[model samples]
Target: MSRPRRFLPSVSLLTAFEAVLRTGSTAAAARELDLTQGAVSRLVQNLESQLGQPLFLRERRRLIPTEAARAYGRDISRALDLVARASMELAANPGGGVLSLAILPAFGTRWLAPRLAGFLSAHPGITINLATRLKRFNFAAEGFDAAIHFGVDDWRGAGHLRLFDETLVACAAPAFLRANPIRQPADVHALPLLQIETRPTAWPEWFRAHGLVAPLPRGMLFDQFAPMTQAAIHGLGVALLPEFLAMPDLDEGRLQRLPGAPVSGTGSYWLVWPEARADYPPVVALRDWLAAETADLRAREGAGDGADDGDRTRTP
Candidate 1:
């Protein structure tokens, strides 16, 4: 399309022409628009120049409309009014836009998603669109409003408020712990180690936390926690699991914490967003809500729904 130039009529011209055609005189249109008669006449001329069609006939000190002018004016006038109404609605509420967020599938399903209705109840007008990702993402290019992401605090160009500090426990089936008899940290070396792809060195890390620096065990590593924890439940092997993520399994008697120390993982979760839009209304609201949720969980000390945590299964 050609760029708008000096010769082309602007929307001002169209407005003046339409007004004059409705009222039958440039002076009347000028009065209605709170402008000078000469200014309105100029606008009519500009409109003709752009449309390449005379919108009005020069009558005796008055403007007479062409058939096309009346039809176009009615449609454009209604459209402009509708635009004004919609713009007013949006300006009244900045928090009502679709909130696009990226999250890990398991974490979203396990934690944040379950409690999302709370946010919705307070901000019902806000729409949420969730996209799942296994790793951190580029917030700007991805068009995300915020992300509930897991990793060490390494995100660049994003404002990261740490959601939680992870406490990882080595948990296995009760039957497995009974059969394996992990009397000390090093005793984990003897068991068949079930592991996840992201943290195969968990056993080493747990051992290191207790002052033992043996090589991490070799084992079957899966990409996700659900399957890896399931392997632990079926007595496949011991898996180093996050207290937040694995606590439920331990409570259900599907897994038990071994008799050893806990390893701190790189991080747990963070409410992340681009630095530019970090203070946006929706982002700030979500950040506050998630921080509150994490704080509440920490106060419970891994005990609420996950009551049967690692502490009880320590086989003295």
Candidate 2:
């Protein structure tokens, strides 16, 4: 009552056909599978006979696939890939590898690096490899498991797990503010200004937040945040820095503000990873850990309740 289905070829036959289609020649397939060319050709011929369709045509001495073969090749290639991945998963362990991450130098040192040893301690089987990217970037091509970078949803080609929504602020040493009174935004122009090489518009944005004008550049620019803050600590000028990244200096009283103004971070720090890697163990774990840590930090900052407005803008 029903036509019987043709028996499917063996995994060996399917693998041989797949290898030839992918590698473009029987000799190449033989090299990949460690089989003789005649052996590989026999496998493809056997597969063709089972389906009763010619998959390749003779071109010179080599067999070339027809358009129909091209279509079949795509499906078979995908299936074989799924099977190979499953096989590897059954044979491999995820928890024992190194988690590679790219991070901004200052954020890593000032905020993240100080706290990551606890993560390493908890997962002794795992380790983290950290490298610095002074600017923002794509995590996939860099071969990083993850990355911590600045900016608002600007990076493409990945999942953006926001770590923190930072609030930027202007700060300086106590002596600088005591000597130079800063009552209004207009006063900032007369004093020395400290600029971060990354965010050239930071000061202008602060002024815009408080209804001041734009494009004010009367200070020195540094390539990194820690150095910019250091210059501020030494009272070179007022530095516009992200508040969370500057907490240590603020805590140590190395830097203080002009008074009554600290701008919330317009940008965010996000953990980025290629979607293809969404399920890797170290990546998922680090993303969760960083998210939780940032939330806790934000909660603590909120509870501080403007009590330490010392990080407000200081005079040059």
Candidate 3:
């Protein structure tokens, strides 16, 4: 069904009204829209006449938007931004093989970025645009073709491709570990434990996995793993980092593994796409590539090998 004509005003009228609402005056809106002040005023007046409602209050030659108009302007602004982004994407990729993918910060930089070259080389015609999304988002609203999701396979209305399970290693700066040595599994609780905002239960689950049952202490909170890993390297606190993320630091001797075995994290990683794009060429290519890429790791995990080995190497 088509939208009511009155509710769906012309883009020009909406742009003019939005500009006036944003710029505070017809003169400023005129400057922004590259129209005469009189023309801009006429546009807003025309919109008001079409809608049969007053959008602005004329007070001493000043235009003050009504509350309803302000609210409407906010929605219009978002819509305009979405339209502009879509336009730009189309302009940039006229041939139409653009894949806008959202990724986790650490995983994208440490894991996927290094391996993207092979995918790009194989599919030279496809362009992959990556954006960092630390948490779940609406695919339709966000305008993403797919996203790297780190959790259980529970994203509603989306298709999932298993990547790999995450293994967490408790690590700290070498100096900090020397100063506060960890001799047992319970010793981790005695020290300041860094926390990731998204994984609030990580420390507790790690402790539980090691057969330790104690209330965890509050410590430094970080929104992402990159900074938390840096904080741990700087002797701020002991952090439970993903094995893939902590491997370089441990290998370079910047951080030492705390006295414990690597524990399985709460969830696994997945490549998720909306159901509508289930057959999208780029999504299918990426899904197949990821499945093939992580086949060995997934097999190892399935076979239950190295369940408690801290020295085992794992790739993301």
TM-score (all chains, Cα) for each model: 0.62, 0.62, 0.84
Candidates 1 and 3: which is better by lDDT? Answer: 3
lDDT of 2: 0.75
Candidate 2's residue-wise lDDT over 133-230, tens digit each? Answer: 87765553355667776875555666676666677877888888878878776677678888877787678778888887754577788888888888
lDDT (Cα, 0-100) at 288 in candidate 3: 83
* Residue pairs in collision within model 1: none
In candidate 2, stretches whose alpha carbon ends up further than 4 angstroms from where it belongs are: 1-95, 138-140, 297-316
lDDT of each: 0.74, 0.75, 0.86
Q: Please, what are the lDDT tens digits per residue for candidate 3 over residues 1-316?
A: 8899988888899999999998899999999999999999999999999999999999999999999999989888888887887788778877747888999999998899989999989878788999999989987778799999998667888877777889999999999988998899888877888999888888888888889885656789999999999999999999999999899899999999987899988888888888878788888888888878888888888735433211112222
**Which order, best to worst by TM-score?**
3, 2, 1
Question: Which is the better candidate, 1 or 2, if ranked by lDDT?
Answer: 2
TM-score winner between 1 and 3, please give it: 3
Consecutive 10-residue window with the lowest summed lDDT within model 1? 307-316
